[model samples]
Target: MLESYSRCWTEIDYAAIAHNVEEIQKLVGDTKIMGIVKANAYGHGDVECAKALQKVGVDFFGVSSVDEALHLRQNGIHDSILILGYTPPEHFHYLIEENIIQSLVSYDYAQKLDAYAKEAGTKIRCHCKVDTGMCRTGVIYQVQEKNMDQILAEYRMEHLIVEGIFSHFPVSDDLGQESAAFTKKQIELFEEVCDNLRKEGINPGIRHIQNSYGILNYGDLKMDYCRPGLLYMGVTSDDAIPIASKPDFIPILSWYANVSLVKWIQKGQSVSYGRHFIATKPTKVATVSVGYADGLHRLVSNCGLEVLIHGQKCPIIGNVCMDQCMVDVTQVDDVKEGDVVVLVGRQGDHRVTIDEISRKSHSINNETLSDIAGRVPRLRRREK
Candidate 1:
């Protein structure tokens, strides 16, 4: 069994991913699922999370960078890795040789990849990123209108394969008419682009657009394949996006830290950097070995952040330092040193969710989890 000495570690439940994938499979009946393991599986451990999802029969893994894909390859993961983010021109050759699928949004970028692939006697399978409404890293609809044929004529080479067509929804979670209408427009545009390509004798292999929110709220968007990242860990920003098919999904990560030091302070005593938190009473404070440096958002300061100690809820006190935080365990009876503090998961009936923390910290759920940096160890949970 793997454990941590710092008392602070991320416990990843592989079974939860399996459970979530099963739910998604039932929802998207007949459609393939391209598991989005980008950003180290949204800080849920990429290699392990991808493997766990693979055990549940996921088709491919999606990442955001070449370095992330390379990490998986080095770890002996042979499953296909799709680089969803923009690949730099300098690394196009490396991307081709490594058998990693990349997204192409510019004609000039495609030409370089084509030249490299042809010289290496290999063909790179890439997806066309349509900037339907996201306005991010995709070919604009306006640009395509002016030079679709010209662009096609430039890179109509045998070494380049357009394997998939995808677009991103701007706001799939907001329950506003404009948000829904805009998302609908993006879906319509994605289809139009692919339809135009097919008419021009171009066959885009996989057609995907539904992200985590899209897969849940807009099932129609889950056409050829669905890419869901945050949902795999059992949370979604969009309440409309159903994940588990059950009442609710179980979060896959639990963050815990051991009580490093238990101390007492008189009333009016201040704690931590900038002396932000003061003792309201003769209080007991326990230092936890976790901070923003370990991916805990600094904005959580003065927020009603709670952690589980001695099976009881304790409020986090003071400004969170780079490597430590203080939690008030004064109300809890028999609380002593070395008791485990639940930072981001359940313990008994009390729990602290990543969504709750993210809201308090003024960030998104994905950023809250994926920001969990290194140094803090991760403990992998397996079923018997």
Candidate 2:
């Protein structure tokens, strides 16, 4: 697993991913767990992580786009794949070819898809998304609402099949009581919609609304399927996971870089491209090969952000460049070029977690993980 062949790379633990899936399965009990593998599996390498979950019998997989679903199919992932977001009409054929489930967010999109499927002489599986609160996608759960059949009007029986109905909870993870009321209302609206659809003789096959935070906080609610996004990646950014969760989630990705060059700057010497970090004293600075392009936010420069070198915390000294950054390592003796530098994850007893990185960058784990550029190679650790 120690392939230091690149200036910057990330190591993904397959065993930890498998462990997360098993634990999530145990948490939700009989409810189907749809592993959300969107955004490259939250930047853990989508196909690799999905394969690991698939090996352990993951109930389903959710992706954000048709291209992502196609990537999984091309990699031989034949499991049930659902597009969590909308699929433009142009890419509708790809969905038909793979038999992947599409999400119907609007009546017009659904109608067009139904007609296209009818002409193709193929049936399409899909889930109807209801907008409980988050106004991004899905049908609004309120007035002007047409029943399921009316929304899906003229859908040839053989052309389109509504396999599930779902809604997204915008504030499900909020700890405050106010957010609680919002979540509850969202759930009630979704249920009411489902009931109205059923009364109208429309089948809502598998019902799911809970995301990672929702599952952690409200898994007991009714639902045929639960989407496990971040939690399945062993990243616990939610409050509920800490309060009463049994599973031990270990971060599966560790970012690393090599000290490509080492130089000693005189006292008062500025580091890197800016004078933002002026050395207070004569110090030895190590040029670690990682930068904003590799996902290290430039905002972290001079933020007292530290990376791990020789299991010691070394402060980032200046502006994070496009391909490199500098850190003061004068306190440590015998430091040299090509030493292993850890940007995230553990280094001996000292560790840098996604939480720490996110705090420093002023962003969430989702952005922190996915911001990792594609240029850096991902090293998958299978056995260990």
Q: On residues 263-372, what C-alpha lDDT tens digit does candidate 2 reach at each position?
A: 88987788878588887788898999999998888988889888899999999988999999998899877778888998888877888877777888778788889899
> Which candidate number maximizes lDDT?
2
Per-candidate local distance difference test: 0.78, 0.82
Write one digit per residue (lDDT tens) for candidate 1, span 1-384.
Answer: 235556578878888887787777666777788988887888888888878887888868899999999998888788778898877777887676678988776666777778888888888988777777777776776433534553354336678887777778778765478988888777777777777777888776788888877777776544888888887788876333434234246678888777889888999999998898888889998988888998888899888888888778888889988888998888888766777778877778777788777877887888888899877788876566
Candidate 2 accuracy as lDDT = 0.82
TM-score of 2: 0.94
Clashes of each: 1, 0
Candidate 1 off by > 4 Å: 1-4, 142-147, 150-155, 238-247
Which segments of candidate 2 are over 4 A away from where they belong?
A: 143-158, 238-246
Measured against the true structure, the TM-scores of the candidates, in listed sequence, are 0.92, 0.94
Candidate 2, after superposition: displacement of residue 77 in Å?
Answer: 0.6
What TM-score should be assigned to candidate 1?
0.92
Question: Which pairs of residues collide in model 1?
Answer: 7-257
